[model samples]
Target: MTGGTGLFISFEGIDGSGKSTQARLLAEHLRSTGREVVLTREPGGSPGAEEIRALVLQGDPERWSAETELLLFTAARRDHLERTIRPALARGATVICDRFADSTRMYQGLSRGDLRGAVDTLHALMIGVEPDLTLLIDMDPEAALARAKARATAEERFEDFGLPLQQKMRAGFLALAAEFSGRFRIVDGNRAPEAVAQDVRAALQAQA
Candidate 1:
């Protein structure tokens, strides 16, 4: 919205909110509309970040300290931003990421303390390159957790957290939406995937 360079869009939500599905759909739509686009996800977009993603999601990051997990997230973000996100935008391509720095804040913040330092440092390090738009796909905690559990062939680190933690994570997302205001849009994630996709398209077009 601000320059001749390409745009960066990020999709964020608690697990099972269908943000990933919607991100894919949006990328497809952009391709169909004849825009150059690259579809990727946080924690594992690039090789370096993928390594960090394994550590963050593979075994039991929930079992570790909240602060440690938050650091890992930022580490992954640094790798992702350097190797993937920034480069795509510089090349004049729309980069659609399924998750981004906002997830770190919500997840870490929900763990009952601030990741303010981490968030600040990440913003400082990244400087002027950040997502142009972030769509936060919102859904009910109970339903989202239920869907996630059923869909999971096996649990990942964060996914293994208790119900109370999941609730906090869900609330954290909405809180983040409130905090960021106009930069983030909340999408109804409980509907059909196609319906959700349409909502995302409208939001992106509105911003355009």
Candidate 2:
């Protein structure tokens, strides 16, 4: 599937929404067709961003205040854009990012409602880039939360927020999709992985 120029695609959802899997599947599909694809994720993509990821994801849920956490996420994203995403796109590659600025908007905003404004302002001032296409993997929060719990990783910091927050995040994502309809595509994530992959493929193919 080709989109005229360098395509920047980001997959976003609450933890366990199966976005990561879809991102991988799409990357593989593109590579099989002879396209140069760069698959990446946030709050870790570049080496410096990955370091920042460890600090944010491995600590106690309350280790950093909401404001502090937002800063860290922003810093990581800046590093990721400068060191990883921008270069790949410059080389005319398709960059498939598992998560992007939207996560910070939803998570930070959902956790501390007042910080939503800060999130937006910081994004405009610091990050300043948006994906050409964003696939929002929509799903039932309870099911997704269960999937997140099953993983039991050290990065449980975000997953540890549990069901209620996941619900809020789902809403937050939908809201963002509405706000940025030009670049967002809401994809159902309740189906089998292959089915979901096909739907994602179809969505991009239509755009192409």
Count of clashes, each model:
0, 0
lDDT of 1 by residue, 77-147 (tens): 77777787777877899999988878777777555467667666765665335578999999888888787
Candidate 2, residues 1-208: lDDT per residue as tens digits? 1233589999999889999999999999999999999999999999999999999998677888888889999999999999888888888999999999889988886654568889999999988888988999999999999998898889998787778889989998999999999889999999999999999999898777
lDDT value, candidate 1, whole model? 0.80
Model 1: residues with Cα > 4 Å off, grouped in runs: 1-4, 61-63, 126-128, 153-155
Model 2 alpha-carbon miss at residue 88, Å: 0.5
Candidate lDDT values, in order? 0.80, 0.90
The best candidate in terms of lDDT: 2
Q: Which residue pairs in model 2 clash with each other?
A: none
| RMSD (CA, Å), each prediction | 2.1, 2.3
Model 2 segments more than 4 A misplaced: 1-5
TM-score of 2: 0.96
Q: TM per model?
A: 0.91, 0.96
Number of the top TM-score candidate: 2
